[model samples]
Target: MSDPVAGSTGTAASGGAPLLGAADLKVTFAGRRGSPEARAVDGVHLDIAPGEIVALVGESGCGKTTLARALLGLEKPTTGQVSFDGAPLAYDSRALKAYRNRVQLVLQDPSGSLNPRHTVYEAVAEGLRIHGYTGDERAKVAEALSRAGLRPPERFFLRYPHELSGGQRQRVVIAGALVLDPELIVADEPVASLDASVRGEILALLLSLREELGLSALVVTHDLGLAWNIADRVAVMYLGRVVETGTVEEVLTSPQHPYTQALLSVLPEAQGEPVVLTGEPPDPTRIPPGCRFHARCQVLASGEAERTGVAQSCRTKELPVLSAAGTAQVACHWAAAKAGASG
Candidate 1:
């Protein structure tokens, strides 16, 4: 229950420097036929310290996945920089290969991640082979399997992906990542495809990995409950940017941004009616001027913006990007105004 990022320098809560960090990162896809470019990730700054778990929470198209891909060096950023251990990430083939050896990715669907044709041992050994791991591959793979909570590692070695259950398949995928002895893992919806009963098991496995291996993670998810259960800190994304961020107890229990409040309001444990905003998220190519979330923000519609005398600013004034290093922060004109008034 301690503040995981109490004295964070935007790099880490543990104060040992960030294992991974992104600064003013942006990823854009050019459109054909003279169409406007789609900015999937726009100006995001994030950090994952050693032994820290930061959940990037948002709806689809909010750019959390794009940001993750950029951090993994999978997607080339249009601007900004990604740093690991205070060194800027390099895009050269050799450098990327070296970077990937230390930073691994766990995709959302375990079924898709594993090869149907390969046995569990082969599947997990693929990474070791790719990285030219010369040391005892068998023993390393077995250890990884055991660490991922697969009992009697050899029992599942010869089995194919189709032969394993969903949870087992996921553990196999995780074992694949662990085999590399990575310092950080970018897990994209790690448990989204599993059955309700299996989700907890996988989550517990991740937590155990963090504790046992001193691993760091950037968990890209939409589930606030999942964030609450696993993440030490939470960053709420909206419209290709982080709208709010803080410790789990701070952001989830006392959300500052309207988008975050609405997200938590709809959770099963919430007492009040959900704050349903009108219309869908704006198109990425044609992001509106000023506050990108203004069109769908409930605070503006609920008269709170007007009450605080910042309705015009909400519709016309762009808020600065949230700082990545802070213990708690929000990007909202109304929230800032409200706080100023209260002060």
Candidate 2:
């Protein structure tokens, strides 16, 4: 696989300008009862090139969803900027409405995303009606449905969400996004809820869509397996920040960050015993002072950092945010030190 990061240009894998990009993005929610603010997304920089698929992988509550929301303009950023086609994203109602039309969202639960009362046709046509599409609404809806793998589009036009299987409902949701002819799709856990048999079908559908439509995507998921299956690039996020990022082949096969290593170690196909970190992720309200992942870092706990004389730094000195627009990068002091020594 080709490296998606193009030095400092922040271009996509295709070497074209990013269809969507986030720079130093942060989202913070005010704490209640006079508590400190909770930083949902600290400082993330990610980009998706035209027709490229980038997976944002992390455990729950690590802020991958918040980062996705920020990219979609659903949540306002406390700092930083989101840009599409090289222009900064605007949050005003009119601007956002247009932005959403170009960048559609495909949620995880198709059942919840679709209205139980609405027929397939209504659900797919809703976007056109809202966007005031002047073209033939029926033709557009049918095309979207066909593209989404719902064959004989007219056959399912009148069907309700309850009438379709899990995979079919997901197709309808994807069709809804496709109907708008969006440039990019931000699918949050696109297949996490499906049966094991149905999961591959959905993943294949996503790949086919990318091939057919040249559509770029930012898939938010926790499953490294899913990332390996569909993503060209993978960004491993921890504690509201990206800790490691590179091509899927590079990052998954040889992950450098301890958090990423721990994640990959637990995969069913992994060679050795899993590396299980103790304790839950630290409270986001009061993140650790140095490396956000320091407390649970296995390398630090194993005395590797101590052997290398970077143990103290891991506990007290902070590392820079790994840019999402570069070659394989890691934020761990030990990993960087090891790389330097090897080089």
Candidate 3:
């Protein structure tokens, strides 16, 4: 697919580190009902520096998985691009083949992802086989298993997907990705299907792998609290665009976008009254004109909403800008003031 959105055109280009970057990405699919095309992932821009973990969070159908598909070159985009190591990639056979080794992905469901018939050894060694493993396949299998914390290696080498528990199956999946020794990894809700007790173990394994390999990752999840704790940076998506992003401390502590603030405030221990968002998310088919969050925002100020007829006319009709200074970039009317105070 072509690069989706514009890349580092403004600030990301001025000075940004990019191991993997997605620029101005738009992913639209034909409507199931033969209606207008559904623009699932629209105009997203982000960069993942070498060894940094960035999480993409949003409501389920707001384009998180679709964006991941584009990033991994699994799905083509309507317009825009995703690049690796500071270079844009075309979907040629060579480029696609090279991507297989340079970047790998951990899927959400281990059971569905792994072949029930293939032994763990076969699954992990498949990457080696495809890439032309000329040496000891057994040695490669042992190394991958060890790295994924599958002790002794031999115990898991003969196990099949159904024979292992949920966490073990996930470990096998991780082992498969590791065999490629990828520079970047796109983990799509690695823990979502596991039992709650197994979630932490899987997350820890991921963190360990990151530290061991110095690998950059884009972790996708709907849980903001998970992103807050695991990600080095967080990008909040709503409708189809990235509304705010920053270092974990900056975004989590002082979120600028109402949507971002609302996301953060919903966490268990977060103070203040529970901010209930009214109305379902706007349909992706006919997104609102500007500031997609305006439909459900509490930050527009009640009186302002009444006087400006914003409730009826949307006071936030003007498209806001996304700004970054130091480690924070937020798309909000108030971010400029924060930038001013910092200056």
Candidate 4:
């Protein structure tokens, strides 16, 4: 019913401050003069401390990509604000250019992100050239390639996109981001296109990079298993809002939000009866008035109200913001009651 608020702090390795954050961000794209505007991201608050690897997970069209873009300064928020190092985001040419050097984006498809006509050297060096790097550009490109696990960098320097395997092309994209020596990386489905075997390698590369360079990453993905594999913290998005977020173990093993429960029930390793959501997620332009998930939530349909107000609140009251439910923060009216029953 009310705007979603995150109650969990999550596990951030850095104690002093977050390296990047989004404070109550909302991004809306206006439709035709008569049509309703599409609210892609609605009232999201997120924090990424230095060197933390956080996963933003959801089904397609859940606005994870839009939120990531807002954090990277790629898209302007319709309201609220984005911050870097405790300061509001800067938009001036000089300030924005400096910001770009600190944060880089790795798109879902490397073939689409990389230039088909450019050599590996040119692809990686583009950032340096644009950023006005006066040093030896060749050395920087070679080192970045090497860091991305493409050893003997010169071997692939002249290779075209068609020449390299799917895995290698993705590696080139990562190398391009690394060439900038960024402090944060916003990787959107970094391994979705690669083979299953290559997925592990790319994830490993991300971990190794964090260990070696102390880089913070915001990984956007739909695969819950991927979040289990590499993320220190996981934020589960439904429609335009975050429903649950916590350490990977807490959220995965004991999800509190109904949407999250439904999602995990379909996981390959999930046991017992799976929750098959009956209806399509509500359209962004016509989001339901109360709890967005109420129309399809099994919990609301079958749950016996432990108190007088729970059921009435589920359908009529605005959904509650994230509140502490054991180890996770959940935006649901009966998360505590459900946890108690399960326990």
lDDT (Cα atoms) of all candidates against the true structure: 0.88, 0.89, 0.78, 0.83
Error of 1 at 72 (Å): 0.3
Ranking by lDDT: 2, 1, 4, 3
Tens digits of per-residue lDDT, candidate 4, 145-166, equal: 9999999999989988889988
Clashing pairs in 4: 1-318, 1-319
- For model 2, how big is the CA root-mean-square deviation? 2.8
What clash count goes with each model?
1, 0, 11, 2
Question: Once superposed on the true structure, which residue ranges of model 2 sit more than 4 Å away at CA?
Answer: 1-13
Clashes of 2: 0
Return the TM-score for candidate 3, rounded to 2 decimals: 0.87
lDDT of 1 by residue, 85-193 (tens): 8999999999999999999999999998987999999999999999999999999999999999897999989999989899999999999999999999999999999
Model 3 residue runs over 4 Å out of place are 1-16, 32-34, 301-326, 334-343
Clashing pairs in 1: 10-325
Selected candidate, larger lDDT, 3 vs 4:
4
Provide the RMSD of all predictions against the true structure, rounded to 1 decimal. 2.3, 2.8, 5.8, 4.9
lDDT for each residue of candidate 3 in 11-93, tens digit (9 for 90 to 100): 23346567877878889888877788888887887778777788898887788888998989999889988888878977988
Query: Model 4, stretches more than 4 Å misplaced?
Result: 1-14, 303-309, 323-327, 339-343
**Which sections of candidate 1 miss by over 4 Å?**
1-12
